[model samples]
Target: METEQLYREHRSMLIGLAYRMLGSAADAEDIVQDTFIAFAQVSEENVRSAKSYLCKMVANRCIDKLRGSASKRETYIGPWLPEPVITDDGGSLEGDPLSRYVHKESLSTAYLLLLQQLTWTERAVFLLREVLDFEYDEIAEVVGKSSVNCRQIFRRAKRGIGEAPLATPSLQGKTMELVQRFAEAMQSGSVPKLLEVLAADAVMRNDGGGKILAATKPILGADRIIRFFMGIQAKSEGAYSFAFTEVNGLSGIVTLKNGRPHGVMSFEVRDDQIVNLFYVVNPEKLTLLQADRIRPIA
Candidate 1:
């Protein structure tokens, strides 16, 4: 009963933490499940502060997983983006109250990529202290570091990340308006219209994980990106349809080819311009999109 209650309360939070650490929702889910199973083994009377204990277990497990998978990610083909967690996909997550507890902004693909820059321990300390609101002492326990060392690690991580990925709530409306305009421009087949919302130095990255077709490198600059999109449109016209959905808690577009997952596009808006675009078409990463029943815009 205690383990079940703990699972009900902490499963979502643990998954969120693990996802941010590993950048794979599927792996995060697996880690959370494994953690709960381990939790069930320990006597309840021996556990102090169940939340802290579970978080520590999950965090350590994530650190180990990241270390073990470091070479795989380093050797990953093409541009690598986090596996997106879709919220508006008419899936269980859309109505799962547990999901509401996860911090949406921190889950953004951009943010998760920034986290990839940090070392595994640094990521753990920074996330525990900054994102999860764990105290220095608590973070220290989780990472097996002294509180002073944890603080130092966090400071280094802060410097590494530099700035937060998600825009402020005030800019959110503007971001959405720009995304709507972007979709309209794509549908209208107008390069000039697409250029209007894109920054001069806009970048689009496509991740295929070597399992599907994608750009081997980032498409740089607004003009180049627009040209690339136009080229794709000309070649695949009517073969793909796009639907607006929330990807990693930000306005994003999901492309469908014949009602199957083609790609998932997430954006980063700064100063009301689309500055960074991430297109994840890797068949492995599109599993969630495949499961969701999305109504494409005609």
Candidate 2:
């Protein structure tokens, strides 16, 4: 295939891979662009498989970025959340069941955060094997490890991250229902209603990047979370407005202040209750939310 055709065909997949790897859409776009540029410079005859070649380039670029940024992340000002993306199409892979399962889990915020705990090699190996369904030998090629060693890395990555809950389509409707209720409670400043919807062990985590007012540590338990929201409601009366929207393929709310994008709050629902809430108030991370096409949930 022509270089342009190859790029056009593989761009979305490559971006998804790189974004999951690096957790930055901007970086992912740049890496994919550079990968194609490098691909264009090479002879088509030398390329055995365009998909594999491009994926290798993008994965390696992500690994390099991860390695370089490890220390910087350690010194980051606040809890770092993955850059949110609009996954209105459900972000499913167009393949067999295994591919769809992997693609769906890999796109979630919890899974991405779990990945952050892994070493660069472990993350790459796990993603290649578990998400991309690459053979051990193929993963060995991508990460420059022996097949046996790659297996070990994958094992370690799995043990480190454990298994994240998959929010299936069956649960989306119930989850959105809870989201709407939570939004309504917040709008009405009803603490009792908010507590009713939140799980007993509900936790709220905010990533303000130390650029805005946010709890430095996670607010644990339903009472504290309710209090936190109540405080906001009391202090910021009429200063903020919220719109229910889909974020990262899940029910979430966008907080707007003075017609500007201020923050995004995505939920993790289990048993029809909010288990975990991720609030991204960091202005830098809110760029994608601001720029993306968002439709309010009715």
Candidate 3:
């Protein structure tokens, strides 16, 4: 097959894998582009499976990126959340690689942060086996490990990461209503109403990347989270307006100030309550969520 054809068919998948691995869509695109450019120059006959070869290339590059950026993340400001990818709401992702891939719960900010707990190699092995469903032999080839080693690594990574706390599909079906209620409560400044939608032990994390003010540590408990928001509300003086939208495949809120992008808030829902909130205010991360893509929720 021609390299251009291969790229068109697999670019979205490749970007998905790299984005999960690196948590940076920008980095993911760069790595995939470089990989395909390198792939095109290679002798096609020598490459047996283009998909597998591309997967290996992207995965290996992500590993290198993670290792190189380890120290930078360690010194990052506030809690680290994955770059927010504003997904389409019954529309086209058009210019974004995440359009086709962000629907999976694995692409959610909460789940991606869980993947951050694993070592670079373990992350590669686990994603290959679990997310992509690559066979042990295929994963072994991708990571340059023996099939036995790949299996062991995957098992270990699974144990370490544990299960994500995202809403199950059945629960997810009710998320829109829940988020709507939450938004209404916020707009009305109804503390009691807000409490109704939040888990008692709900936690909120803010990532400003040191560019803007944000909480340095998580605010635990629904009450505290409410108070935190209230404080921000008071300070902002009604400057921030929120719109309901899809974020990382789940119902979330996009905040705009002065008709410009402000931040994004993605939720983890379980048992009809918002259990965890990932708020990313980092301007660099907010660039993808253009004003035209968001609409206010009434």
Task: Name every residue pair that clashes in candidate 3.
Answer: none
Compared with the true structure, model 3 gives a TM-score of 0.94
Cα lDDT of model 3 by residue, 1-298, tens digit: 9889998898988888898898888788899999999998888777777888889999988988888998999999899999988775456546456677664554667788989889889999988887778999898888888999998999999999887755345555677778889889998999999999999999999999999989989999999999998999889844867898878777788877766678999888878788889999998887666666688765
Question: Rank by lDDT, descending?
Answer: 3, 1, 2
Error of 3 at 17 (Å): 0.5
Winner by lDDT between candidate 3 and candidate 2: 3
Better of 1 and 3 by TM-score: 3
lDDT of 1 by residue, 184-221 (tens): 88988888889899999999999999998678899999
- The prediction achieving the highest lDDT against the true structure is 3
Q: What's the lDDT for all of these models?
A: 0.80, 0.77, 0.84
Clashes of each: 0, 0, 0
Q: Write the per-residue lDDT of candidate 2 for residues 84-127, one digit (tens) a residue.
A: 76555333434322122224443567768888888877888887
